[model samples]
Target chain A: MRRHERHEMTEEARQELAAVDAAISGEAANGEHAPLQELVRALRGVRPQPSGEFLAALDARAARGFRRAGQEHARDSSRGGTARAGVARGATQKPRRRALLALPALGLAVAVVLLAILLPGTGGPGPQPRATNAPSKAVFGAAQAGPAVAPDRAALQPAPAPTAGPSAPGEQARQVERTSTLDVGVAPGNVQATAQRVFTLVNAFSGYVRQSNVNSGPSGQGGATFDVRLPSSNLAAAIASLSHLGHVRSENDTTNDVTEQVSSLQRSVGDQRAQRASLLRQLSQANDPQRAAALKAELNAVEARISQREGQLRALRTRVDYTRLALAVTPEVTAGASTGDLTPSAAAHDAGKILSAALAVLVIAAAAVLPIAAVAIAGWSAVSLTRRRLREQALDAS
Target chain B: MTLVAPRQLATPQQRLERLYAESREDLYAYLASLLGDRTLAEDVTALAFERAFRRRRLFNPRRGSERAWLFGIARNAALDELRRRGRSAALAGDLAAEESSREDHLEGVLRRTMVQVALGVLSARERELIALKFHAELSNPEIARVLGVSESNAGTMLHRAITKLRKACDAQA
Candidate 1:
C-alpha cells in the first residue's frame, strides 16, 4: 500500500512538470502551472548578487579602460589634425608653384613666336635691283683715252656734241643676262656620248662651248663638265635639250642687266672718234714738222682709244645677248662601284656635305621645337598642379 | 525601471554611461548564470563594459536596445571563460552522468536542486538560450537578434531547451 502511495505522488510530479514545460513552450499560460511557477519564482529569488567590493572593482577597471581609450583617441585626432594642416598648406602653395614654372615657359613661347614672325625679313643672298643709266666706271685700258690729257679728265669731259637721239624702245628695254649650271646623271660608259650630244645641241642653238673636260674614274665610270654660252633667245630650249641627255640632278639659273654699261661704252667710243677727227684736222693744217708729228701722235692715241672702247662695247653686247651655262655630266651606275672608285677624298667630301645638312636640320628643328616644348611643359605643369590640389583638398576634407 | 533614452542626441560617453546604469545588474546576473560563477561573471561584466565603451562610436540604437547588445558581449565573455577553464568537457560529463542516473521523486528544496542540476545537464547552446531568455530576460526576438537566429528559430530552440530541462528535472526527481 505504501508503494502505491509513492507511485501516485510520482504521477502528480510528472503532471506538474508537463504543465511547466507547456507554459515555458508558450502552449499554456503560467497560471496553468501554479505549483511549478511558484518553484521558478522562488529559484529566481535565490539568484546570486555580486558583492559590493566586486562591483566597485569592476567599475574601476572600466573607468581605467575608458581613460586609456580616450588617450588613444586624442593621439589619433592629433595626428589627423597635423596631416590635415599639411594638406591645407600644400593646397595653398600648389598654384603658386605652377605659376612660377609656367611663367618662364609662356615667356619663351611668346619670344619664339615673335622670332618666327620677324626673322624672314632679315637676311639672305637675294637679287639686287639693277641700276639703269649709270655710267660704266670700268676703264679697259690706258689706250681708251688720249696721252696728252689725263685719263680721268678726258673721260669725264667729252666734247660738246648734239644731245643723243632718244634711245630706241628696244635699247631702252632692260637687258637681263641669263646663266645656268646643271648636273646630269648618265649611264655608265655614256659620259662621252652625252657630252657629244650636248655639243651638238649647243651648235644647233648657235651656242659655243667655252670650256670642256672629260675624265674616267678608276671604276671606268666617266664624267664630263662643260662651260657653254647659248644665245639668250635659245636658253630655254638648250636647257630642255640638255635635260634629255640623261637625268638632270640639279639646275640653277640667274639673270643680270648690263644695259647701262653697254650704253656708257658706246658713248666712250663716240667721244674717242670725235677726238681722233679733231687731231686729224690739226695734222692736215700743221706747217711745222714737230707740230705735225705731235698732231699725228694725238690722232694715233685717239684711234687706239677708239679701238679699246669698241672692244669693250662688243664684249658688253656679247654678254647681254648670250646666256652662260655650266653643265656637269656624271655616270649613273646601277651597281656599286669598285672600292678603288671610292677615294678617301671623295668619302670625306660626302661626309662633309652630310654633316652640313645634318647641322642645318638640327638648327631648323631646334627653332621649331622650342615653342612647342615650352607649351607642352606648361600644359604638364598645369595638369599636375590640378591633380595635386584635388588630392590636397580631399585630404583636408577628410 | 530606467527607460532607454534616445541615444541619437547623446554623446558617445553619455550614451555608454546611460547604457551601463540601465543594464549593468541584468547583464551581471545573466553572465553569472551563464558562467555559473559570480567572480568570473563580475570580471566578464567589467570586460564587456570596457569593450562596449571602446566601441561606442559604432553603436546604432536603431539596431537594438543597449541591453541586448551588452548581453551579447557578456555571452561571448562567459563562453570565452568557459573555454579557458575547460569546463565544457566537465559539463558534458556531468550531463552524461545525469542522463544515466534518472530518478522520479523529489519536492520543494530537492526539486529546486534537481532543477539546478538539470540546468547543468543542458548543452552550452541550450544553456545560452535559457540564460538569454530567463536570466537576461530578453524577449524571443531580442534573443534571436543577439544569437543571430530567426525569432521563430530562437523560440523553437528555447522551447526544446526548456523541455529538456524539465525532463532532466523530472528524471532527477
Candidate 2:
C-alpha cells in the first residue's frame, strides 16, 4: 500500500482494537460477575458447603416465605367480600357537576353586565310624534287692490322715523343721513311694530315710505324685512332711531347727486310743450284741410314727448326726495343661545357617549369568551401532547 | 399429609405481617433499582401494598399469579413516579444496575452511558425505543406487537442500536 493508504489502515486497526478493549470490560463486570465467580471458586476451594448460621437463616427465610404464601392465598380467597364494600364507598362521593356547569353561567352573567354598562339605556321608548291638524297657511296673499285705487289701499306703509330733533345740537350739526342693519339669530315676533317704528322715524324727519315687506322669514324662525324710502335730509335721523329697535350688525349711508337728472328732465319737458304749442298754431294757419290735419299729427307727437319727459322727472324726484332704508328684524338669541350649543355639538357628544358604550359591550363579551377559549386551548394542548407521547412510547418499545 | 389452610380470617395486622414476610426483600430490591434511592424504595413498597390491598377485589387469578400482577403494578407505579419527577440523573444509578451481570462488562457500561446520552439527543421516538429495549426488557416480537411493526423490523432496530452503542463506546475510548 501507499503511505497514505497504510496510515488509514493503521487508524482502522486502532479503532478495532479500542472496540475490542471496551467489549472486554463490559457492563456485566459491574454486576455479580467477577466477584460472584471468584466467591464461588473460593467456596469450592474451602469445602463446597454453606456455614451453619447461613443455612439456618436461609431455611428460616424459606419457612417464613411458605407461611406468607399461605396467608396471601387466604387473602385472595377473602377478596370476594371486599366487592360489597366498594358500593358503600360510592354513595359518599360529593356532587361535583354543579361546580363544573357554573362556569358557562358565570360567563353569560358577565356578558350581560358588560352589555348593560355599554348600552345607552335611554330609559324608555322615545316619545311618539304628536299629530297636528292646522290648516295650510298661504305664503303670499294677492296685492288686494287695483293699480289705480281702492278704499283699503295702502297710503303709506311703516318706515323709520328720524331720530334727530331740532333741539338736539349734535344731531343738528350732522346733516348727512345714515342707515344700519340688525342681525338676530331668529326674527322677532312683532314685525308690524318694527316696521311702524322705522316708518315713524323717517316720517319724523319729513321722509316718505318707499316699499316694505311685513312677512319675510320662514315660519319656524319668525322675522320680517322692509325697505323704506326716506328723504336724504332725514336719512341720518332715521338710521339713529332704527338702531334703538335692536343691535346693528352693519350700517352704511350713501349720498346721490340727482341735480343733473332733475334739470335735464325739466328742460326736455319745457322744449316738448313749446313744440306742441307751435304745431297747434301752425295747424290754424294751414291753407288746405289736409295741411291742418298734418299739423295736428305733429302736435300730438310733441305732446307724447312732453309726457315722457314729465314721467322721467317724476321718477327722479321721487327717488331723490325719499331715501331707501332696508330693515331686517329678528328675534334675539340672548347671551346663552350664542354660546355654540346646537345640533352638531349635541350630536357629537351623543356620538362619543355611544362609542364608549359600544366599547364597554365589547370588553364584556371578550371577558365572557376568555375562560372558554383558555380551557379549549389547554385541553387541545394536553391531548396533542399526550398523543405525541404515545407515539414516542411506541417508538421506544420498538 | 393434610395441606395447610390459607389465613382467610386473619386480622389486618396479621395479614400485613404475612405480606412483609413473603415480599419485603424482592419489593425493596426492585423498587431500589427503579427509584435509585433506598428511602424512596421503602416508601413506594409500602404504598404499593396499600394500593393492592384496597384494590384487591379486582385481582383475577387467570391473568398470571398474584406476585406477577403485583410486580406489574409496581412497575407502573415506578414509571408514574419517574414521570412525575421528570427524567433526572437520580434515576441513572438504578437503571444502570439491570444488565450488570454479563461477560461484556466494560463495553456494556460504556454503551449504556452512551445510550443514555443518545437518548437525550434523540427525538422522543428514538428515546422510547431505547427505553423499551434495555429498560423494559421486552422481546423483539413483543416490542413489534406493541409498535405495530414486524418482528424482523424490531430485531433490525435492536441490532442497529447495539451497533451504534459499540461505535459510541469505541469513539469514547
Candidate 3:
C-alpha cells in the first residue's frame, strides 16, 4: 500500500512536502539583486528626455526631402519649371566657376569649322598653278590679223599646152571635194613604209603629193616629214587613208584666204576693160589734145589696178586647186640609238616621271590628314577646357 | 469648405498590428527586462513586428491562433537580437542595475522585486526562456520553433533551467 501511494505521489507534492522549503525559497534568491536594483535607479537618472528642438530638426529634414522628391517628379513630367529650379539648386549647392574656360573650346570649334569651309582652295598656301608646255603652241604658230602675201598669179595663169610626152595614166588633176589634216607621232620600225603608204594612199584616192620633205635627222636619229596635196573631192578619203599610217595623234582644218582675192580680181578686170575702150576712142578722135591727155592718165592708173587684180585672182585659183597636208614621221627603229639595253637617259626620264607622280600623291594624302589632325586637336582642347572649369569650381568652392 | 481630418486614425488590420496596439507597453517592458537596453529593446520589438507581418502568410490557421504565431515570431526576434549583441554585453547586468534605482514604491513591491532579482542572477538564455514561457507566454512547441529545437528538448531544457534557478536561490539564502 505504501509503494502504491509512492507511485501516485507527484513531483509537485514532493517539493511541497520537503522540510527545507522555506530555506530553499530564501537561499535560491539571486546574489546580484542589489547591484541590479542600483542600476535601475541609475538608468532612470541618465536617460535623455525628448525635447521640442529635436522634433523641429526632424521636421526640417523631412521638408527638404519632400521638396527634392517633388522637384524630381515635376522634371519627369516635362514642366520645365522644375528643371530650372533644379538647375538653380544645383548651382547654389555646387562650387563657383569661371566662364572664361569655355571660350577657348568654343573658339577652337569655330576655327575648325571655318577652316573646313575655306579648306579646298585657300585653307593653306599651296604651289601656284604651273605654266603649261603644249606642243600645239609651237606647231601651229600664232595667227596674225593682216592681209597675207599671195602667190604670183601671172605664173599661175593657164599656159600653152605642153608638147606631148607619154601621159602618166593617173595624171589628171581631180577637184578638191573635201580636205582634212592628220596628226601622227612617227613611231620606230615603220616610219618609211608609213610615209610611203600615206603618200600612195592619197594618190590612189584621186589625190596628189603636193610636197614631201625627208629629214634623216642629225647624227643617226632619223625622221621624215611630208607635205602632201590631195584632190578636194577625195580629201575625206585621203584623211581616212592616212589615219591607218600609224596613229593620228591630233588634227585641225582651216580654209585659205581665197574670198578676198576673188573679189579684188573681178573689180580690177572690169576697170581695166573700161579704160582700154576709153583709150581707143581718144586715139580715134586724135584732133582733141585734152581728151587724149585725160585718156592716157586714166589708162595708166587702170593698167596698174588691173595688173594687181590679175595676180590676186590667179593666186586664189591656185590655192583652190591644191590642198596642203603636213605630216611628221620618225624612223621606227634607229639601229644606233636603241640597239642594246635601256639607255641611261631614258631610265632617268622614267624615274623622274615616277617620282613626280608619287610626290603628287603624298601631297594629296597630307592635305587629307590635316583636317583629321585639326579635329583631334579640337577634341583635346574641349576636354582640357572642361577639366579646367572643374578645377576652378573646386578652388572657388574652397 | 474643406473638412478637417481626425487626429487618431489608427485602425488595426492584421493580428500582429492588433497585438502591437494592444500589448505594446507590456511587450516593451518585458523586452527591456530581457535585453537591458531600452533603445535596443524597442528596435528589436519593432523589427519583430515587421518580420512577423512579412511572414504572416506562412501562419497556419489549423496549427495555432494569431496570438501564438506573433508571439513565436517576437520571441525569436528578441533572442536573435540578444545573441547578435554577443555574450559579454549580455552578461553586463546593466538592466539589473537599472531596476534597483526605481523611485516608485508600487513598482518596487516585494513580489516584483523578487522576480527582478531572480532574473538578474539568470543567464541570458535562461532569462530568454523564462520570458518566452511567462511573459510572452508562448507554448513549449512555439518556443521550440522560435529557438530552433525540438518541443520535448525545449521542455526538458526549461525544466533543467528552472531546477537550477531554485537551487541557486536556496544556496544564496
Q: What docking tier does model 3 reach? A: incorrect
Q: For residues B6-40, what per-residue lDDT tens digits would candidate 1 score against the true structure? A: 64536877767777776777787666666555545
Q: In model 3, where do residues sit more than 4 Å from their true spots?
A: A1-398, B1-12, B79-92, B101-117
- Scored against the native two-chain complex, candidate 2 gets a DockQ of 0.05
lDDT on C-alpha atoms for all candidate structures: 0.58, 0.46, 0.47
By TM-score rank, best first, the candidates go: 1, 3, 2
For lDDT, the strongest prediction is: 1
Task: Please tell me how candidate 2 rates in CAPRI terms.
Answer: incorrect
Per model, how much of the real contact set is kept?
0.10, 0.04, 0.00
Instruction: Give lDDT tens digits, candidate 2, residues A75-129.
Output: 4444324321221122122125345556666866776776565555422221111
Task: State residue A18's C-alpha deviation in candidate 2, in Å.
Answer: 84
DockQ of each: 0.05, 0.05, 0.01
Q: Cα miss at A256, model 1 (Å)? A: 51
Pairwise lDDT winner, candidates 2 and 3: 3
Q: State the interface C-alpha RMSD of candidate 3.
A: 20.2
Model 2 has an lDDT value of: 0.46
RMSD of each: 30.5, 27.6, 31.9
